[model samples]
Target: MPAPHILSVFDQDMDRLQAQILSMGGLVEEAIRDAALALETRDDELAARVVEGDKKIDALEEDINTAVVRVLALRSPAAGDLRTVITVMKVAGDLERLGDYAKNLGKRVPILAQAHRVEGAAASIKRLAKSVRLMLKDALDGYARKDLDLVRDVLQRDVEVDQMTNALFREFLTHMMEDPRSITSCMHLLFISKNLERMGDHVTEICEQIIYLETGTRPEARPKGTSTAQVDVPYPGSRT
Candidate 1:
C-alpha cells in the first residue's frame, strides 16, 4: 500500500488527468455540434470555426498524454488506480479521433455549400451528428460517474447510429441515381454520414474502456445494426 501522503499525491494527479480528459471530451462534443449545424445551414464561417477548434482539441490530447506518462513514470499506479490512469489515456485518444472526424465534417461544408444540394440530405446528416454527439456526452458522463448502466446505454445507442447511417446511405444513393447532377453533393454527404457513424464507433470504444476500468473485464460483443455493405454502394475513397 502506498503511504498516506503518496496516495494523496497520486489521487491529485488522477484528478488532474481525469479533468483534462473531460475537457477534451467537451471540446470534441462542441466540434460535432458546430459541424452538424454548419452542414445543415451551409454556414461556411461556422464550419471554419469547427475546423479551427480542432487544434485545441489536439493540444489537449497531447497534454493528456504527457500527464499520463508522468503518472505512469512517477507513481507506478497499480491495480484499480492503474486501470483508471490507462482508461484516461484511452478515452483521450478516442476523443481526439472524434474531433478529427468533426473537422472532416467541417471541411466538407464549403464544398457541400457550392455543390447542388441534395434534397433533405443536410437535415439527415444533422440528425446523424446529433445522435453521435449525445452518445459521446453519455459515454463521458458514464466514465465520470462510473455508471455501468450509462456505459451500456452508450453501447446500445451505437446500433441506432449505424441504422441511421445505413438509411442515409440508401437515401443518398436514390438521389444520386435519379439526378446525376446531385452526385457531387451526395458524395460529400456520404462522407459526412460516414464521419458521424465513425464518431459513434469511437464513443462506443470509450464506453468499453469505461467498462474495463470499472470491472476489470471487457464488455460482451457489441450489438450491431444493419450492415451498410448490404446496400452495395462503394464507400467514397474505399480501396477496391
Candidate 2:
C-alpha cells in the first residue's frame, strides 16, 4: 500500500487534473456561444475569432490527455482513482469535439453572410445553439461538482436541442422551396444547425462519462427523446 503522504500527493494531482478539464470545458463553452452569435449577426469577424480560438481548446485537450497518461503510468492508480483518470481523458475528448463543432459553425458564417438571409432562420438557430450551450455548461458543472443529478438533467435536456434542429430542418426546406435564391444560405444554416445538434450529442456523452466516473458502471441507454424522421426530407439541391 502507498504511504499516507504519497496518497495525499496523488489526490492533489487528481484535483489539478480536474481543474484543467474544467478550464478546457470553459473554452469550449465560450466557442459554442460565440459561434452562435456570429451566425445570428452574420459577423464574419466574430466567426473568424471563434475559428482561431479552437486551437486553444485543442491545446488544452492535449495537455490534459498528457497529464492523465502521466498519472496512470506513474501513480498506478487503482479502482476509483483509475476510473477518474480514464473519465477525465474521455471528457477532454468530448470537449475537443465540441470545439470542432464550433469551428465548423464558424467556417459556415462567411458563406451565410454573403447569401440572402432566410427569414426567422437565424433566430431559431440562435435558440437552438443557446440550449445546447446551456446543456454543455451544466454537464461541465456536473463533472466539476460531482453532481449526478445535474448530469442526469443535462442528459435529458439534449432532446430539446434535437427537436429544435428537426424543426429548423423542416422550416428551412419550406423557405428553399418557396425561393430558390434562398437555397444556398438555408443550406449553410442547415449545416450549422446540424453542428449544434451534434454538440448536444457530445455534451450528453460527457454526462455519461460523469455518470460512469461516479458509478463504476455505465448508465443504461435511455430512449432518445427526439425523432429524426424529418431528416428524410430531401436536401434543397437534390434531384430525384
Candidate 3:
C-alpha cells in the first residue's frame, strides 16, 4: 500500500487526468455540433474555426499521454487504479479521433456551400450529427460518474447512429443517380455522414473503456444496424 501522502498525490494526479479528458470531450462535442450547424447554415467561418480548433484537441491528447506515462511510472497503480488510468488514456485517444472526424466535416463545408443544394440533405445530416453528439455526451458522463447504465445506453444508441448513416448513404446515392451534377456535393455529404458514423463508433469505444474500467471484463458485442460499407469514399486530406 502506498503511504497516505503518496496516495493523496495519486488521487490529485488522477483528478487532473480526468479533468483533461472531460475538457477534451467537451471540445469534441462542440466541434461536432458546430460542424453540423456550419453545414446546415453554410457558415464557412464556423467550419474553419472547427478545423483550427482540432489543434487544441490534439495537444490535450498529448498532455494526457504524458500524464498517463508519469502516473504509471511514479504510482505503479495496481488493479482498479491501474484500470482507471488506462481508461483515461483510451478515452482521450477516442476523443481525439472524434475531434478529427468533426474537423473533416468542417473541411468539407466550404466545398459543400458552393455546390447546388440537395433538398433535405443538410437537415438529415444535422439529425445524424445530433444523435452522435448525444451519444458522446452520455458516454463521457458515464465515464465521469462511473454510471454503468449510462454506458449501456450509449452502447445501444450506436445502432441508431448506424441506421442514420445507412439512410444518409441511400439518400446520397439516390441524389447522385438522379442528377449527375450533384455527384460532387453528394460525395462530400457521403464523407461527412461516414465521419459522423465513425464518431459514434469512437464514442462507443469510450463507453466500452468505461465498462472495462468498472468491471473486470468487457461487455458482449452490441447490435448494429445495416452496414454502410458500400460507400467507402475516403476523405480528401486523409493519408493513403
Measured by TM-score, the strongest candidate is: 1
Off by over 4 Å in 2: 226-230, 234-240
Deviation (Å) of 103 in candidate 3: 0.4
Per-residue CA lDDT of candidate 2, range 1-240, in tens? 569977998899899998999899888888888988998898999999999999999999999988988988889999889988898899899999999999999999899888998888878988988899899898888887889999999888887888888888888878888899999998888888888888888999989888987887787885474565537666557884
**Which lDDT value does model 3 have at 79?**
87
lDDT of 3 at 3: 93
> What TM-score should be assigned to candidate 2?
0.93
Worst 10 residues of 2 by lDDT: 222-231
Clashing pairs in 3: none
Q: What is candidate 1's CA lDDT for residue 183?
A: 93
- lDDT value for candidate 2? 0.87
Deviation in Å, model 3, residue 124 alpha carbon: 0.6
**What TM-score would you give candidate 3 relative to the actual structure?**
0.94
lDDT of 1 by residue, 1-240 (tens): 569989999999998998899889999999999999998898999999999999999999999999999999999989889888888888899999999999999999999999997878888888899999999998888888888898899899999999999999988987887788999999888888887888898999999888988888999999898777677765557674
lDDT of 2 at 17: 93
Per-residue lDDT for 107-170 in model 3, tens only?
Answer: 9999999997899999999999999999999988888888999999999999999988988898
What shift in Å separates residue 97 of candidate 2 from its native position after superposition?
0.2
Instruction: State each model's C-alpha RMSD to the native.
Output: 3.6, 2.5, 5.2
**Which of the numbered candidates is closest to the native, going by highest lDDT?**
3
Candidate 3: 10-residue stretch with minimal lDDT? 231-240
lDDT of 3 at 143: 80
